[model samples]
Target: MNNIVPIPLSIGNTPIRKCDFLSEYFKTNIFVKDEFHNPGMSSKDRPAYFMIQDAIQRNRIQAGGTFVEASSGNTGLGIALIARQLGYKVKIFVSKSCSQEKIDKLEEAGASIELCDNSNGLQDFQSTQFRAQSFAAKEQNAYFTNQYYNTQNIRAHYRTTGPEIWEQTDGQITHFLCGIGTGGTISGVGRFLKEQAKAIRIWGVEPRGSILQHYLKHRTAPNAVRPFDAIEGIGRNFVPGSFDPQPIDQIFQVEKDVSIDMAQWYYQHTDIRCGFSSAAVLASLKCYSAAMRFHSDDNVLLFFPDHGSRYLSKLYAENSKVSTSNAHSLNG
Candidate 1:
């Protein structure tokens, strides 16, 4: 009798596949974890599901209550879907930077929408987060799913995603890479991998304009941090409470243009359309290649945050006009 564990095809159990195309091109064992398999089609589904459950377990909310949150897109949509399914009303505050597709989906999931100017480079991104808090304060039975500050954000990944990767990879993962946002995913997963093997390298990828790298160096966010550069969920002008930089081995920043090109290249070669931030992780690996520390046999996994459907209006709108040939070459 076989003792093999059947792979789960459900939320929080997305598949991790070794990419032969990427491994061949990069001359290393490159694996891509497809978070799009989640019901919300993104890694945000994990936290959204976990946080809401946390609220219920702790009596932070009850049936027919209201859920409140601020999101660039994925988190809000995830909450909206969960809240709707569990008989709760929801309100989502979004930065102008959020794509129309995400907003439409949030509405379809029965979320009352509010707009914040922070995402449009008008002010600090925290404005949206604070706005949601204030709104939740004045509303009846409104439980704020403060993803940015809530420790539950990290707990979600630590409890579920971290163990999933360890078990799925058979405890052989050598490196864990992903884009940093609220800092929950990397912090939770990175910390977990570190505990399993202190030798595991945790590399973080950041958008060029993101202040996370700046915060890591200066221990403070800049007063005039650059706004989201056409990519959502990865770049942050303010350091979120969920962000924990302790487990990160290195942080790589990539330009938006190059990240966009690589995302398309990945799709053309693999038929897997990933979100822009996830593409940034791919570009980060290219930058890491120059260091030449990674061996061909090392198992390196890149965590893709979400799917491309949420970014269709922006990142994938004119995909054909861009070519990856000039994007980033091993020689260059």
Candidate 2:
């Protein structure tokens, strides 16, 4: 009998497609890393797979073991899908602020859900992370994939995502941009790109309420951080241990309304359905283009972390309250 391969094993090698519309509109070459093509439908699949595999290899977890984590949405979905495929039980402690679509997806993936009240703040122990940690501590044969602090998160992207981008762009990528979450994507990809070509500029995008902008500017975490904005999968009240700001050349702060409107516009115009965080990067790209004149030869790459399907209740909802005037002012 042949050994069965889990579906989650087929996670990486997502496609990088050139954005003809964006390129012509911006008057420069622009490419998008379509992470939505991943089996888990998000870039979170990369790190989640790596972390789980590493845990298994190190005997930290075994078959039929329990996997636990705290996430806003995408990461939990990735882990849940992978765990289900590998016959592991998954318990996700997610923020109550996460979209209904995401919660539904997680439940459909056969993962037990624990909704954490994030109205106060996400960084506190009373938040999702605390609940996840406490659950893992009490459960037998349970492994907590602490994505934020896990070095494996960065290593996953460095070994896979970074190399894939380097090869896909034929080592000619000039600028790489993405929204910062656990900082794994930017840090890992940035390190690899810079190692290959020192001139490659790595830009980190953050929401207005995120502490990353303040941290990047002041070289320290802020004293009093605000609640995480409506945008999910990116931004944090506190910097994660996995985050490495050293390779980032600059950080751009985008507003929640701007991200939502930009995402909707991108979907309408280019037919590329990206989530709010990805749109934040797009908005930042526009801001960056306005400030800096790009040569025709310059190649800019942006990572679209997840698809817009998971944002139906927020970014794509019919009753969603997005400011058209503000979006036009930014894009116009």
Candidate 3:
């Protein structure tokens, strides 16, 4: 008799689903890299898994070591899932702005959660990151999986995500769209696609309040902190070290209400629930369709980084004040 063991979780390829609704609406071919199919239920699994494995190879993390990180939500969940399985103690310092559902999910995954005030905005390094850094510094055998600044974050996408998209699209993708948080997904994937096809246009999506759009347009960082926007996982008040703005051909800024509305619209039409950032990308595509002059033959690829279940308390709340029709009108 042959003995078999179960395959480990978090080791598989996620599928790319065609966005038929969006394709018909926009009159262009569109597809979604459905990253929610990942074991951690988000795209962060790719980088988190690779970063941890790289650290182990470098002897920076070993058995019984502690893993610490600062995350809004998804990255922390990814790290916790991998670290706990690998015999490491996981601690996540997260901003209070993160949904309670995410905090509860992290705790359910056996990670200790420390909530930090995000009211001061991203420029104030004393927010969540400083606290996480301080905790990692005190631990004798701790590894900080600093997703924002870690070069491995970019490398992981470059190695895995970029190739997956290229192969899935058969090198026919003309426009690559994604929301930028740590910027690894856009920078790495953009570099790969641009290398393969010079004419491929890479567009980075951000919430209206984020400084990235301004920074890209004016080539200067904002001096004042923008108003708090409810959308998470994409916009940043400060530029992260992993972010390489050079590969991005253009940046699109979407309003918070529009993101929320589009998220709801996607669920209603396609039954594929996505987070705010995913909707932001869709909304941006709709808003820019006229100017970009997308053709029916153009193959547009959008990255949906996480599932909507993680955002039940915020974007998917039952008592959301904004209506879908109003949001569509704003975008239209």
Candidate 4:
């Protein structure tokens, strides 16, 4: 792998594995997309690679100019990885709540980091986004690549992610499940899959407190509001501009412990180790497959969003209360 030059800038050819544990318990076939193999250790690498490529092609990024954006973790890592190889200066604004390990990785990738709202304790996603915007506004050469509003993020999924899944599954994919963050993964992939086969079921996984599930169930709500949850990388105070709510068949809200347990169990049982979002997705998949009892031959696909390595100190460390308690509860 070291001999390969420039790494070819491609997303992983992730495999679909039938979950033996889940199949026995639920009496149905269950499959997962192992996104941890992607370059940046998460599915976000797909969009990050393409987003930078598109920016270069369109001349949105001047030669040797600095790139700037804000992200929770994976997106920043994605941008920083590409910028380092391409010889561009990069700075990423991250929320104060983001893991220190992620910040260290970003800095290691040659990115300057700005901590957003560190003093005031702005833990909310919307507040952090607002702070990122405020910082972006003052930078002279900074390009605020809004992942939430950017069509490129969706286009990345539409052109690359969706095609890869469709081809990999050999058109046998009957249901799609993903952790919804920016809605790019769901919107783009869902659109393409629907266009290819209208029978496909697209479900978005949200944190327990997220409004997306509620919004999908009841479109008549007067206004959207933000709620706090332990889950990361999915759900926002408001719907992203890139989010297309119509194509979503269902939105499943998962508990924090459920996600933590699922991720830990996967790492323990399988070779794949992914972030909490992946666990939420697996939990959702279990629930969905159990209720629907998918046909014996039918294929059900779940997207494992990001790797859990970045969450080591918090999710993997012995001193980390969340993982310890979650493990205890699961044992109980």
Model 2 spans > 4 angstroms off: 1-8, 119-123, 319-331
lDDT of 2 by residue, 123-237 (tens): 4777888788888999999999988888989998999999999999999999998999888999899988889989998999988788887877788989987676667878888
What's the candidate order when arranged by decreasing lDDT? 2, 3, 1, 4
Q: Candidate 3's residue-wise lDDT over 86-192, tens digit each?
A: 78899998887888888998999999999888623345666787788778889889988888888988888888898889998889889999999888999989888
Taking the tens digit of each residue's C-alpha lDDT, what string does model 1 give over 1-332? Answer: 22221212257878999999888887888888888888777888878887787787778776698999888889988888777877889999998878898899888888999988764221344567778888888988889998988898998899889999999999999989999878899999988989999999988888887788877777787888555555578877767889898888877888887787777777777777788789898888776676747788899999998888887877778764346466456334
Q: Hey, what RMSD does candidate 3 come out at?
A: 4.0
TM-score, cand. 3 vs. native: 0.91
Error of 4 at 208 (Å): 1.1
TM-scores for all candidates: the values are: 0.90, 0.92, 0.91, 0.86
Model 3: lDDT to the true structure: 0.82
Best by lDDT: 2
> What C-alpha lDDT values do all the predictions have?
0.81, 0.83, 0.82, 0.73
* Model 2, CA-based lDDT: 0.83
Kindly list the per-residue Cα lDDT of model 4 for residues 1-332, writing each as its tens digit.
11212434566576667778666544556677877777777777777776676667666666677666667878888888877787777877777778888888888888888887521112444455665666566866556666777788888788877888899888989888898878899999999999999999898988877777776777643274545465767766566767878778988878776776676766765655677777788767655555655777677787877678878765566533335545554433
